[model samples]
Target chain A: MSARTYLDAGGRAPLHPRARQAFDAATDEGWADPRRLHAEGRRARLLLDGARESLAGALGCRTEEVHLSAHHTASLHAAVLAISRGRRRIGARVVVSAVERSAVLAAARFVADETPAGRRTAGLPDGVDTVGVDRWGRVDLDRWQEAVSRRGVALAALQHANGEVGTLQPLGEAYGHARAAGVPLVVDAGASVGHVPVQDTWDALAADPADWGGPAGVAVLAVRSRVRAVRAWPEDEDPWFPGGVSVPAALAAAAALQAVLADRERADPDRRALVDLVRSSVARTVPDVEVVGHADDRLPHIVTFSCLYVDGEALLTELDRRGYAVGSGSACTSGTLEPSHVLGAMGTLTHGNVRLVLPRGTVRDDVERFLHDLPEAVAEVRRMIGATGL
Target chain B: MVDARGLACPLPVIRLAAAARAATPGTVVTVWWTDPAARHDVPAWARMRSHTLVGTCPLEQPADRTGPSGPQAWATTVVVEGPPAAPPD
Candidate 1:
């Protein structure tokens, strides 16, 4: 266990120490239903409101604009569906980057398919429009403009950064186009909220607690008051999220965000350097490997690469045997029949993929050791599948 | 012709490369690949091996529909460019 290296903290991190402490305390003070008029409920509500304010301060939004959801995907689903419903008088067309998370894409498609059958075009799908991306996994701004500016377009959603490839999108430019079209833009900053400076360029934003070394039960969603978004679910006392979120989880998430923000300026650059080291070493030492995503315009702590003539699962297993934990976006390993939409949309090789997300405070020596073992692991995986000497 | 349909990932390209290795230069190696990775990996493998990815065309089912792992076939053709195989005659 002492020798093991974990680089696969994709959307979840080990709970921050401060977060653990906060969660333990909140478990006691924040356990009430938070809806009753009783004193216990008032205490829970206070804790919940305080957490919301903390997240809002970190996100650069108003406290009222920030709300908590059960998890990250729920926040995105509500953002997509409610925005579509709110703008129902307008056409149902929703524009999303090709590299958006599967949850976002699925929700977009759901609302698109919900459009009246007669309203749909003969060949084209009416509800959603997908904009293609470049080989670097960055969205094509010109194409995005064309899509968003189309008549009757309801809303647009683009992730701040792709978790799989670590490529940061041109959110400033993309958001500008959406604004000019009078279309609200939703930014899924789940991958960038804690690791990078999220621009205030979004009309609505979704963040993941798991992404910030917090407890996984709560997620943050901030919607600008003018996004024309209504609750997607049935009318309830709590419109955004019907059932209240766990107070303890919300408090833990808040504490973790504050702790991460305080240390990020000092810790992020070191993580960036370690990632750069792995990028250079892997490309230099390994043969037929492609280091993917934008070279400079990317998340600091994430690096992804694809190896030719190697199976993604086999390579992952080989690395696991060496006590190195990594991630794969390849279809065989992704648990989905299709490979990563991010890598596929970028026209990159999707097999033999490895995604390394360095958690905060990852030691440099651990990364170096992993780099030392990576080449041999890839070579051995290739050889096992009768792919050697070709 | 090699049928790598239902095989995931590097298997498709690996099989293609293995097939190309036995043929003389300019011999065409055809493969039916279902794994979506072949769309990029086969071309990538061809370029890395100095082989020619001559033709590619989508077959029966388009790969975009997400669900269980099954054959989502696409026919790909690569022409060999390396030296001839060892003769046993």
Candidate 2:
């Protein structure tokens, strides 16, 4: 049987060939803990440091600023927890963009639970603030600035680019707003690290290696040295991430990051072209399909669209059956059966949302096949829905 | 008949199971659904319970002539009848 081709990189991107080689080579050696002072531990630590240095160089950050974690989820959680700790004196609230990953949203919700009975917390964290986004998934800077001016916000979290719609946030504007208010900004760069340029306007930034063709588990959280350290629970004074990093995964992640970044300048045009093809094809194929994201400012390899009168989950399955893997907002947010939080925040159609994220080795033929097959799949789904009177 | 037209995954399965229990042997339970996973899920659920799948069809036609959103369009509609055999022991 032939291997399945995955078009849903939003869920997880495939590992790079070089990354796989690094992983295979270090399998036995990466088993040891890096904290131990033994020879094996020292070797593991050296590998981890090398990985960190490579990733840091790609991100245009310092080695000391980058901390590795289990995955993007862990890194984001740790960063959010740290920033919200002991900030009750400033405000019992946290401010986060509505389009953040579920991990960030959950962390904010966790902090919100800790707030002391509604003294006026802004965001998800107790004493934090929450902000909304525009139709293109950009944070409403005017509203955000207004809220910050009124309250002494503790930490502000905004993703560099939305994972679903691929809309690039105004990081420079957001960072300036937060810095002017003396609040630290935590930027989630998970969707746009090597594929797109990393914006350096935030106090701290978090990225996943897998997004850039790296290994899945390794994530980088970059913290400026001068920022006040906010530690997550478990009360580890040393560092929040006590689990010693995996040297091989880190090395693989670094290798992937360096490789993608080195080739980004050349690969970007092709990636953008592919995305445009998907965008135009979907628009032409599906009636009332609104392609989400900024046409120019969006990520090169990602495209999202919402189909009216079609269920997102249903569309995904139909596409999958046709050998085209796609992700939907409905599957991503199902507890309430509402559209994607990002789409909701952006005031876009949420019912039939699907995000097509291209992998590094994706070819033109596959895209053509997907485009050719999508309309049929969508029509099949809509027909199944009994969507009448439309 | 259970209407789970706009529901997501697992919910449809859960609802189908609930409806199935209320049905007697040889009862035709029509499930209206929009989830694409239902194409596989409805059949899988029916097979697991030893029910007989009667029919599955799309609700609407596609707007486009070619592409993924083509003529075989529409979400799915599944009809299953309870088995004549004994229920789970």
Candidate 3:
């Protein structure tokens, strides 16, 4: 077998060189709690403050607006619950795009169901008012306007870009509709923050450090001062997150963010071209396959396709045998073999789906090799399933 | 008639493909599938192989759950038009 190539880089990017350096330096110095009064605590405080400032500068938000959390899902839950709770007087309803992360949808559902009015009307059409999306996974702005304009919506949640399908949402218009309706929009920028340019299109933004070559322990949640977030959890010294995150991890995440951003102008175009190639190549070579995202308006590093008459798990196993690690969006690949809600929401084929996310330092030849092997792997899986001679 | 009611993705399509290969032209094969993946794949397979997909609708969940109709399966009717351009499966 050839050398193993890592193409499943969605939330598993290898740490950036800068992140490694930052982590090493911060580990020894930032071991103490920032809230403590000792000399060690002050050193840790400086690291945490510096990390927040750099992240704030990157996100175009005030340092005070930025808060560290345990992970991306934690940040999203906090944003959705806290913001919705803060504005409960307006209404307990949360307007969210259908294709937002499951965490966002679950958070919205929880906030709606937890309320007194919601308990009575839970699971009703008015509960967690969900806006639908197009076949390409773009949320319908017209429906969005109507959902947010409804009499009792507290907040809205939408992802900046979908990580699974790599489709970018029209945030400017989505945010505008919510703003006009006096609703705060919480944007999950996990998939777009490092790969694509961050747009000023959210009232509350939750970014995933792990998505951008940072460690997995910390995530960035920035809430604009104007946005009301009624601390959902018990009020502690740190209102945003009770225990706080690893200061060293936060610093390393910041450093990685800076590194990826600095290299964006040089890196994104190449990544985009490679993705475009992957998209076209899959469509051209593989029969009975549907490339599921918008061809033009998508993330620079991710692409997803669904193949008919093949099992995703089998195909992934075949590719693995061929020395390539790719991601899959199929029921068979998921431990429970449950269908993907993302694909289901788009009304796209959810079986035999393959997802490839090119890491920061992905090589061209490996991609070419994967493209060459994909047709055979797909064909083999198809044949194994008695779907041959097509 | 093919009842693919309980199987997930490739199985439903594979069963339907088997039916198409065995049947002569003008044979109408009905497959009832409950898995969501088959909802898209069955139609796609029909279109790809030139089989005629007559129509589809939700199965009234049996008043009581029982039997091999894959679980909440919908009935998909397809007419075998002819052999596909490629070699037989």
Candidate 4:
């Protein structure tokens, strides 16, 4: 396969040709609702089931364990709402990392505000609590343990790896903490699934195969049978999803996961080298740029840096014009600017935050081009900000 | 001058309010900040309080030069000319 160019892995990577072939094949089939039980529906069901099975096999879980959803955000909302409904009899506190994806955070807030006045608030309900993360984006385990030690804490959600900075969390330790406290843990593996091994410690795990070279709009929520969580809505009652599932996308997700895992051993080392190249080059090329994340204990394919005196929006735009389709708060949010929450949580500078997430089969030439182009981009942004003296 | 650097949300605005009250009429007060939200927030704050924004400048380099991680790193400096009010006693 030929190497395609992409500077933004957070949004979408250029689809691997083989994965693209599989995706094209999967989408070619008619869009029959899998629930109809008719011939076409049955075929859709078969594709859905095959996807669940392949995804489950790749993750080393049962086929029945996988629940497909539209995207990571939707899966997170469903899981949070499901857990909240199930644990309503107990309490409504949803302990989560302060730096969790905004989708999950917003859902928790919605539960808090919309639930009945006399009822418990959505997040850290009256008796519940929220925990803060450390500079490295790891939940302060000691603090989490302290919070969970208090009785009646119902549910906990933490990401397996941070999305922006790419810092891997202490999920195994968190799993032990949640287990010891008798609280069910929901791990958001959206950023970690195929890149790293997800511990079976989670009561429910949320992942997106696209993060590992899979198709978009397909995500999984793995709920352990031992954990009984009711769906928060009528639409979420399907057993296959424990909530409703998207069958076709699920099939594609499963295929993509299988492909990525099979190729991981060969791809990871190369990916890591690319990450290192970006990290080292940024440090050397851009003066006053702070590289954020756990330098060693992080996702092998992601490297993030914050360039001082440069507006993130301007920097991203310049990079885009230079043929590097990079991501920034400026681009993602359409220029209604704010510093990245992940960078803010890590206590790093956020003026010009840029992340380099390497797609599979990323080549030496692409990395070199990015390295050569990025410094100029940063310098241009700095000049525009009138801080060239620095 | 108001030192709002390292302060989180709302605090910078709060400090700006307090500084505005303490300044003499038409005196230019610079608010040093690192919060990205401030570019929008500070101007909104100045407008709300009816203060004239004289100019805005990036803190080019600290009087004491240091690495990026130190005090010299941030990129925004907001200058607000105070309203017609006497200095706080």
TM-score for candidate 4, please give it: 0.79
Better of 2 and 4 by lDDT: 2
Compute the lDDT of residue A362 as modeled in candidate 2. Answer: 89
lDDT for each residue of candidate 2 in A1-390, tens digit (9 for 90 to 100): 344557888637888888888887777766566777999878777777788888788778899888888888988888877876646567646788888998998887777776665554333334446788877888899988876655656678889899899999988888898888888888999998888887679877998888877877778899888777657455542375776467888888888777888889999999899999988888888765678889998988899987655667778777777677777776433545344677667666556678889998888988988888788887787678665333
lDDT, candidate 1, B15-63, per-residue tens: 8877887888988777998777788778767766788777687666645
Task: Summarize candidate 4's per-residue lDDT along A1-390 as a digit string, tens digits.
Answer: 333357677636555565666666766662678777798888877777787788777766888888787678888887877776677766666677877888878777765555565664333353336677776777898988887666556678888888788899888898898889888888888888878776677888888767876677767888887787876454534653444565555666666677778788888888888888888888888876667788788887878876655566777778777777666542223443355666555555555668777777779889998898788778887677555542
What residue pairs are clashing in model 4?
A112-A122, A236-A243
What is the TM-score (0 to 1) of candidate 3? 0.92
- How do the candidates rank by lDDT, highest first? 1, 3, 2, 4
Worst 10 residues of 2 chain A by lDDT: A119-128
Cα deviation at B22, candidate 1, in Å, is: 4.5
Q: What lDDT tens digits, residue by residue, belong to model 3 across residues A1-390?
A: 569988998877888889989999999999899999999999999999999999999999999999999899999999999998888767788888888888998999898778885535553333688888898999999999998998878899999999999999999999999999999999999988988888788999999989899998899999999998788568787789998888899999999999999999898888988998999999999988888889989999999998987898999999999999999888888876457888877877788889998999897888999999999999988888878864
> i-RMS values of the candidates, in order?
1.5, 12.4, 2.4, 10.3
Q: Please give the ranking of all candidate structures by DockQ, highest first, separated by commas.
A: 1, 3, 4, 2
For A80-119, candidate 1 gives per-residue lDDT tens digits of: 8898778877788899999999999999999887887765
TM-score of chain A for candidate 1?
Answer: 0.97
Candidate 1 has a DockQ of 0.53
Q: Cα deviation in Å at residue B32, candidate 3?
A: 0.7
Clashing pairs in 3: A331-A337, B5-B69, B5-B70, B6-B70
Candidate with top DockQ is: 1
The segments of candidate 3 whose C-alpha lies over 4 angstroms from its true place after superposition are A117-126, B20-29, B43-55, B60-70, B78-89
Model 3: how many Å of interface RMSD? 2.4
